[model samples]
Target: MGNNILITGAAGYIGGSVLANFISRTSGPIKAAQISAAVRSEEQAQKLSKLGVNVIQVDLVDETAVKEAVLRNEIDIVVHTASAIDGRIPSHLIKALGQRRKVSGEETYFIHSSITTLFSEEGGWPYGQVRDTDTVFEKEKEIGGPHPVRQTNILVTEQAKAHGVTSFNIVVPHVYGRGSGEWRKLSVSIPAYVRTSMAHKIVYKFDKDGHPPAAHISDLIELYALLVEKILQKERIPSGEEGYYFAMAHRTPWWAAMDRIAQSLHARGLVAESKPSIWPSDKMAADYLGFPVLYVRAMGTSSGDLVPVNAYRLGWKPKWDEEQFLASIDDEVQAVLELDTVKATIFDLLTSADK
Candidate 1:
C-alpha cells in the first residue's frame, strides 16, 4: 500500500467510479490514502476531498502539468479514464507516466480505459465471434472504415510497451445502469436513444442488426479493481497484443432493447406505437434524431459479438446481466421522463407531430 495511484477524470463516470471503488475497498492492495485524483475545478476538488481523495486541480491538455503531477506525487499506478468525446486519451500523459517509473525506480502500472466497440468495428458480431486479441485496429475494410479511437488505442499500447511500463487497456462497451460516482449520472449513448425515442414516438433499430455487448457500471468497476490487484501483486498480467480486457456481461440485441423501451413508453401512453421498426435510411434517421449520419450508423450497424475471454482468465465475473438491465427499463426510462427539460422537449415533439 506504499504506492500512490493517480486517476485522471476522477470526477467523471468511469474515473469517479474507480475512485469510489478504491476509496471504499475494505481489504486490498490499495488504501484510501494511497489514491489521488486529477480534477479540473475547485468545486470538483472540494467534492472529492470530502470523500477522502487527495485532489489536484489539473489541466489535462497541458502535458507539462500532467508530467509534473506524476513526478511530484511519485505515482506508481495510473488509471486513465479521461478522454475526448471520441475516446481519445493523451499520448503525452502515457509518456509522462512511463518516464516517472524510470526516475523513481518504482515499477509503474497503468490501466488505460478503452472501449469494446473496437471489436464491433472489426466486422464480427452476430455471425463471427470476436475475442479481445482479435482487435480491429489493424483489420482491413471495416464497416465504419478506420476509426480515430482505434488508432489511439494502438498507439498507446505500443507506447506503453516501448517505455517498459506495465499497462492494461480495459475495453468496455455500451455501459448501462446507474453510476455510483458523484458526477454524471447517465451514460451518453443509450440515454440519447431514449431521449430520441421519447421525442420521435418511435423506436428505431436496423434490420438484421445484432445486439451489442454491454456491462453495468458496477461490474466494469469490479474488473478495474481486479486488474489493479493483479498488477500490484506483480502477477503475469498480459500486455501488448493480449492486454485488452473486454468488460461485458450480456449481449443485448438491438431490437430487444428498443422493444423493451418502446413498450415502456407505450404502456405509459407516451407513444402510440412501441414496436421496433427499421430506420428508413441512414440520412432520415440522422435527420430525425438531429445527429450526424455516421453517429447514427455507428449506433446501429457497429454492434456485434464481443467476448470477455481475457477478463474471465483473471477469474473476474460479472454479477449483472441483460435480465437485470431489462428489469430496470421502467426506472431507467422514467428517470429520463422526470427531467423537466426533457418533459418540455417531448411535449413539443408530440404536439408538432400532431400538426
Candidate 2:
C-alpha cells in the first residue's frame, strides 16, 4: 500500500481544492496513496466524505484530538492548510508524525501552507527582495516580531526538524480563481472586496499602490500536486529550513486590480461608479470588509518583493500570468456574486484574538 496522507482544513478553499486535485488523478503516485481529510465539523466531514476519502472531524486546537486523528489514520503525510497563524496546530501534528515514524518505522512529511504576505514590508519582513532559495528561515528569525504567521513558520520548521519529520512550507501569495473544492469555493481577498463594494455601492482602493505576488487557484494547486508527487516518488528536493517554496505565478497590481474590479462591478450594476476611490481610512475598510483592523492596511497595500526559484526548480510550471489575471477581474466578480456561500472562518481566530 502507498502512504496514508491526511489533509487538514478539508472544508477550506485551499485544502478542499487540494483534496479534489489529489482524488481526480487517474494514475500517479497520488492515486496509489490513501487519502484522508481532517475537518472541523460534522457538516464539513459529510460534505467531504462524498469525495470518497476518509473524513475525520476533529478540533485542531486540541492537541489530543489532533494527535489521535493523525495516529489513528496512520497519516504518513500531512497537508496542513488550516491555520497559518496558529503554531500549536502544526506543532501537535508534527509531534504525532514523529510518533508515527517510530511505530511504523517509515518516513513522514508535513506540508505547511503559509502566507506570502509575511514577506512584505507591512508584514514585517526586513530583507528586501528575497528568493525562495534564500535563507528565509534565518531572516524570519532575525526579524521576528508579533507577526503570528512568521512565528508559525518558524515553529513549523524547527518543530518538524526536532521531530525528525520532513517538512515543506509553501509560501502562498494572493490566491485568485474559483476553487475546485466542495465548499468555500471563493478565495478571501478578491471576494471580500467584491462583496464590500456591492454592499457599499462603491469601490475603494488603498492610497499607496503596490504589486504583490499572486497565483490563480489552479496554478497553486498544480504546485502542491507537483510537490506531493515528488515526495511520494522519494525524490529529495528540499525539506525543513531549506524547503520554502514560493508559489508566486504573477504580481498583482493592487490599483489596477481595483480599477478593473470597479469597472466590472459598475457594469454589473453592483456599484455606483466605474472608478475606485481611495479609502478614506483603513479603519472603515476593515469594518466594512470584516478584516482584522491590524492587518487591513497590509491586506490592502504592501507588496513583497519576492522571487520564486524553488517551485520552478522542482518542475512546477504555472500557466497563469499577470495579463491573464488582470483579464479575469470580471470572472472574480462573477464568482463572488454566485458562489459566495460559506462564511470565511480563516480569519476568525485572528480577529477574535485581536479583540
Top-scoring candidate (TM-score):
2
lDDT for each residue of candidate 2 in 250-343, tens digit (9 for 90 to 100): 8999999999999999998989999999999998888888888899998889899899999999988899999999999999999998999899
lDDT of 1 by residue, 45-107 (tens): 888888867788897777788888878887888888876223224566777878887888777
Clashing pairs in 1: 125-304, 125-305, 211-253
List TM-scores for all candidates, in order: 0.84, 0.98
Quote the RMSD, in angstroms, for model 1: 5.7
RMSD of each: 5.7, 1.0
Residue pairs that clash (backbone atoms under 3 angstroms), model 2: none
Candidate 2 TM-score versus the reference = 0.98
Q: How many residue pairs clash in each candidate?
A: 3, 0
